[model samples]
Target: MLFGKKKEKVHFNPGNRDDGVDENFVEETVNKIDEDDVEVVLKNEENIDKKFSGNNSLSKYMELGRIMVSMLKDVKNGRYKNIPWFTIATVVMALLYVLNPMDIVPDFIPGVGYIDDVAVLTMGVGWIESDLHRYLDWRLENDLGI
Candidate 1:
């Protein structure tokens, strides 16, 4: 404790009642975003690698990113058709949010920039946990890497 202020632990509130996430807005944002955009993002894992490099402090969001990567890969290859459009939209929206540096908090803050991103992601993935876990397990079972 010699040189700087202790960073406040940014708590993520995933809501108690209905998780407090505005699903409609998330869906609309996803719907408005071009599928090409999502594809572009999904296609460029280097971009994802770069984005993840900038903020390693938030693993939860990164985990979400991994989930999205799996989903995106499946969708791109025509191997999985069971993903609902809403889920796809939400995952794409989270990826877009992470790539944006000037979100609810600017990424230049050094210590607090990615808090909102983490919160957004934690909430975004709340409803999709089962699907993600299933996909993750399937990947494990099938020895898929991406």
Candidate 2:
């Protein structure tokens, strides 16, 4: 302490609510998703789009979900293979989370219900942004429009 400044305690605050959808939860859920789950998400694409259509901000995240679905489909069909498995799983998890009505904040709730869904999608995008960009680049190179 003689030549250095006094140490100050630092408190960490995540600023997150009590919603059960944290990083660890997302990771666990992502790990559990398989090809079948991705298919389920694909089948329910209409519902997912409808659910997020009314709001502009939510619509953006919805589009991200759609892009993820396309990437997943391409990967499954062997059309695209540049993405990592973790990225694929994260996308599936985000889509599944949006499709579920009984998530941390039930979709049926008014106003703030989709907040957690958006958060999950945002987190997923953050985790796989580079991979996503590479996929997009591949799509452009192949003339497969997004």
Off by over 4 Å in 2: 1-27
Model 1, residue 145: displacement in angstroms? 4.5
TM-score of each prediction: 0.74, 0.79
Report residue 44 deviation for candidate 2 (angstroms): 1.2
Model 2 residue 8 CA deviation in Å: 43
Each model's number of backbone clashes?
0, 0
Q: For residues 37-121, what per-residue lDDT tens digits would candidate 1 score against the true structure?
A: 6676687656655665655566555666876877777866766655555566567777777778899998778788777777777
Candidate 2: C-alpha RMSD after superposition:
12.4
Candidate-wise lDDT, in order: 0.64, 0.74
TM-score of 1: 0.74
- Model 1 global lDDT (CA atoms, 0 to 1): 0.64
Compare the candidates by TM-score and give the number of the best one: 2
| Model 1 misplaced regions, further than 4 Å | 1-17, 54-56
Query: Cα lDDT for residue 74, model 1?
Result: 82
